[model samples]
Each structure stands twice: as structure tokens, then as C-alpha cells.
Target: MLIYSILFPILAIIAIIVFFFRFRSGKLSLSSFFIWSIIWIFVIIFSIFPDSSMVFARVFGITRGLDFIIITAVVLLFYLGVKLYYKLDKLEDDVNKIVKEVAISNEISLDDEEEK
Candidate 1:
């Protein structure tokens, strides 16, 4: 067996354990845990049986199994990155709005200060 076949599965198992712990600790939501588990499980499965990925390559018209896996990983990562970027932008806008409201509400007028 190829070394990566063994190494990848081992690494994937470690990742799954981390995800499980995070889920138990409430650091990861159920939906996120499920998604990450599915991804890692696939990694373990495919690494152990590299030929299984060949089926996907044939169906997708990819020239090689490794190519298919790389392409899929790239696409998934790009989608996740875009989602994160949008979420972060929304959070920044929300924080700015809240800060502006708080500042306005807490402001002390010059006339009020002079009267003190």
C-alpha cells in the first residue's frame, strides 16, 4: 500500500476526533460538525481505497483520481472562503452601526458641559 494511503486515513481520523471534541464542547454547531464529519469521512474512505475515487474521475471526465480530488477540494475551499468573507463583512457593518449608535447616545453636548 502507498504510504499516503495509510497516512491520509490516519490524519483524517485525527481530524474527525478533533471535530467530535469541538462538537461536544459546543464550539462547533451541529450542522457544522455534520458537514466537517462528512468531509473527513470521505477523505478517510477514499484514501484507504484510492480506486474508489476512480469512479468519480470517470464520471466527471477527469483524467486522474488525484486531479478530481484536487479540483473538488479547490472548489469546496473557494465556496467556503466566499461564504466566510461575506459573513465577516456583514459582522463588520453590524459592529460599525452599533458603535455609531452607542457613540451618538453617549455624546455630551458642549452647552450641557458649559452649564455644569
Candidate 2:
């Protein structure tokens, strides 16, 4: 009957399809799959019952449901961004450590061959 009524289900279905494809293709990790599934389920629930957001906003002293959603989304995105950055940095450090070890080992073996 309404735009959201039509849009929400479409978006939810698309997200589910993407999730399945990514998971099956090994592009998405198990933890990420569960996290995204929960996020999509919440999106569907909020889209279907927007009035709940209003109640939530009132409780939090926010003026509108849309504003509450926007603020929450922004904060969540920022947090996830910081988390991913740290994870990538740690991975890079690990790779560098492994590479350094391999290089040192090869250098030692080369020296031994020269000594022989």
C-alpha cells in the first residue's frame, strides 16, 4: 500500500540473496554472514514497524524516527570502520613478520652453501 511497504521487502530479499551468494562463494566469513543477517533482519523489522523507531527516539530524547535511524547508522558505520582498519593493520604486521622470517632463513642457508 505504501512505498516503504514495497521497498522494505525488496531490499530484504536482495540482501538475503547477496548474503547467500557471498557465503557460498567463500567471499564472506561465517561471523560476517551472521552479523549481516542480523543487520538485515533488523532493517526489515524497522522498515515494517517504523513506529517503533519513534518510540525508541522518544525514549532517547530524539525528535524523529528517521533522525534516530540516521544517527545510529552513522555511529555504527564509524565504529565498524575503525574496527576494520585495526584488523587490516594487524594482518599487515603479521605478513611482514612472516616475510622477514623467511628472508632471514634463506640468507642463512645461502651463507651455509658459500661456506661449503
Q: Which is the leading candidate under lDDT? A: 1
Candidate 1 whole-model C-alpha lDDT, 0 to 1: 0.91
Output the TM-score of candidate 2.
Answer: 0.77
Compose the digit string of candidate 2's lDDT tens values, residues 1-116. Answer: 67987798689879988998999999998898888888787788788887888887898999999999999899989999999999999999999999999999999999999999
lDDT of 1 by residue, 23-61 (tens): 999999999999989999889889888888889899999
Computed on alpha carbons, the lDDT of every model, listed in order, comes to 0.91, 0.89
The superposed Cα distance between candidate 1 and the true structure at residue 69, in angstroms, equals 0.3
How many Å off is the CA of 110 in candidate 1?
7.5
Which 10 residues in a row give candidate 2 its minimum summed lDDT?
1-10
After TM-score superposition, the amount by which residue 78's alpha carbon in candidate 1 deviates from its true location, in angstroms, is 0.5
